[model samples]
Target: MIAEGVKAPAFSLPDASGRMISLSDCIGQKVLVIFYPGDDTPVCTAQLCDYRNNVLEFTRRGIAVLGISGDSVESHRLFAEKHELPFTLLSDSDKRVAKAFDALGFLGMSQRAYVLVDETGVVLLAYSDFLPVTYQPMKDLLARIDAAS
Candidate 1:
């Protein structure tokens, strides 16, 4: 994982709608970059749904939540729509971005992880679970963000 206090690596990926989203686009805002294993798996679904359910907490803190996976844009679109996820779901089909953040797992899958980037683009937190079933709750992430601030 990228170390805290380091500048976040820049990345441009397609969102569910196929629009390119870049880390530079959020230069002046805090962003929670969530790296997940896949789109519709049981754990991935639960993990994303947790964030989707509490999306207001992030928005209220002026934070943007971005979910990324190795899934294609079409897959991301279907997953987000099916889950009613309000946050942006990004496609990292090449796993380049995932590797940069150390979220790449065995077999080129994206490891379930979270990277918190501050308004200045510095990493505040970098965490990844060894197992796909584990995930950090939105509240815990919010707490980390609050404490970091």
Candidate 2:
């Protein structure tokens, strides 16, 4: 996983709507970028569902989440609609964005993790691992945001 306090490279990955969303689009706001191995998988589902369940908290803290994977936009559309996810899911079909973030093409897919970036694109917190199925890091980030707010 990439270390904290480093600059997160900018990206313009396509969303389910085929719209390009870049890291700069989230300027002046904190962004939570969660990278998962794949969509419609067991652990990935739990990871996304947990974030989906905590969308309110994320919003109340003035943060936004973007889930990225190698899946196509159509796949992400189905998953997001089916699960009612509150955040945008970015499609990195070519794995370019994931590779730029050093979160993809490992183990034949993107690895599961989260990167919390400040308005300046500096990573405040980063987590990389597929075994953990909890949202502790997300919670921790919320706590920091709450304390700062």
Candidate 3:
């Protein structure tokens, strides 16, 4: 897992709309990247819904929430549409971004992890949820930023 205070790797991956979603674009803003193994699975679905439900709260704190998976762009598109995800869902077909962030393992699947980056792209919080039972842990990320401020 990535440690706190490390500079996250820069990335430019395609979103559901094929737009290049670059980490640099989000550098000056708070960013929350959620890495999941696949789309439409029960745990993944619940995890995403957790983010969706608390998305307004995150935005209220000036945070951008992004979901990344090795799933194809089409899968992301359907998942986002089906869930009405208000934020971006990044596509990592070849897991390039996954490898860079060390969010993957030798099993060839994106792990269930969360990374919080400050305005400078330095990681302030990191967690890997083996079984995410709730979304409230994300609030801890916001708390960390507030404490830093």
On TM-score, the leading prediction is 1
Model 1: lDDT equals 0.90
Worst 10 residues of 3 by lDDT: 129-138
lDDT of 3 by residue, 88-119 (tens): 99999899888777789568888788788889
Model 1 alpha-carbon miss at residue 53, Å: 0.8
Question: Which model scores highest in lDDT?
Answer: 1
Question: Measured by C-alpha RMSD in angstroms, how accurate is candidate 3?
Answer: 2.3
lDDT of 1 by residue, 95-120 (tens): 99999998888878998888989999
Clashes of each: 0, 0, 0
Q: Write the per-residue lDDT of candidate 2 for residues 57-101, one digit (tens) a residue.
A: 888767889999999999999999988887999998888877777
lDDT of each: 0.90, 0.80, 0.82
Cα displacement (angstroms), candidate 3, residue 47, comes to 1.0
Stretches > 4 Å off in candidate 3: 131-149
Query: Worst ten-residue run, lDDT, model 2?
Result: 129-138
TM-score between model 3 and native: 0.88
- Model 2, position 96, has a per-residue lDDT of 80
Model 3 gets an lDDT of 0.82
- Give me the overall lDDT of model 2: 0.80
